[model samples]
Target: MDSGLGEGSSGYSTMDDYESLISTTDAELLKRAWRNEKAAPQILRYEAALVQRSREQIKLMEETVEEFTSSGVDPLTVSLYQMDLDRTLFLLRSYLRVRLQKIEKYMFHIRKTTELWNHLSRAEQNFAERCIEDMEQHMQQSVLSKLPSSYKSHLKQSSSSEEDDMVPEPKLDTYVICRSKKFLGAFQLDDRQFLSIQCHLLSWRMNSFIFLMSMNFWTVLKTLLTLKLMIYTLYLISL
Candidate 1:
């Protein structure tokens, strides 16, 4: 692997360094974003690079899996590689989704801040535009849109209201509930069932804690009794 380092230093040994560099870059971008700086351009650039790298990695892993299969490598080893590819794709998708979510959440501010838009690089502006369009299309196709007609009507009314000065930022609890619903649905469980399981788990944990504490209490009591007996025996011997 080239590691994208200088030619003299390009080797597998530098891959870790390259990873650290990318991680550091991401951290800096996130910090800027947290401070509400015009970091969209940098974020878009980083996102593009990461997406490209993920695609290349996925392709390479697929090729490697094919070669291993052809060479009659153990099924377990090939499966592990397949799992890695799956995880890579999952992470890539998650990364893009989160970026889009943030962009969407802050779209109102982005639009009103002329300086922010001006600060964006041409590539970043393009990415932002395309991302907005894609997010709208996705929402149209998503389960959210398929929700009850009443919900759809409510959304339409809220969106068309002219009196609203700005889009309200999503509540943290709402975001958490949305994510939790998706997570539960992934395992074919509803919120009620998930809650039941959570309660059961909590109860089990409490019971286990009580049992351990009781055992510890008995151990301490026994130790104290033994020490008292030894003290009494020592007094008798001294007498």
Candidate 2:
């Protein structure tokens, strides 16, 4: 059972480092399990391997504690090792238990059809059926018996209302006019209004230009009158 738990340098003296290693291994296994449901047997084998490893680790920790006691090591160091060992055992057991729980929950779906049941070995089929039976019994005794009548009724009412609620059709106002007769009429109206605005602007600009030209004409006339008066005055002075 190559659990894929890495046998790296066993020189990690701290609980944190050991936890990191275990967490990494557990994450990889979980990823694999999630990726393929058919790999349940492999997952179970890996879990068993981890359990074995945990047992070995606990034994080793015990021996280490014994050695430290005889060798005058600090009591705190021994207690730390014991704590780490206990934590490791707890995590390993929890990991295995969770996997088993998932297996039990999904056992029915895993072997729902005869074809699927036939594909499994006798032992696998038996194990799956056993899990199903156990789960069914547990649910009947613990979950179904504990459910309140009001909660069940509410659930039924909610489901019935959800089924009854038909999606309403969109209102006419929500529709956009793209290429209908109404759209063409609206576009023509808008075009006419835009043309009217343009005509008004052009008319105003032309009036302004005419007013400026008239002002220039008046200025030129006034200058010519002054020049003519100067010429007449010079003529009078010569006479």
lDDT (Cα, tens digit) per residue for candidate 1, span 181-239: 00011122223322222211111110022111111222322332232111010101110
TM per candidate comes to 0.36, 0.32
Question: How does each model score on lDDT?
Answer: 0.42, 0.40
lDDT of 2 by residue, 133-193 (tens): 7766886577655676532321233334643222221111111111110100111112322
RMSD of 2: 37.3
For model 2 the TM-score comes to 0.32
How close to the true structure is residue 94 of candidate 1, measured as C-alpha lDDT?
58
Residue 43 error, candidate 1, Å: 7.6
Backbone clashes in model 1, listed as residue pairs? none
Predicted structure 1, TM vs. truth:
0.36
- lDDT for 25 in candidate 2 is 60
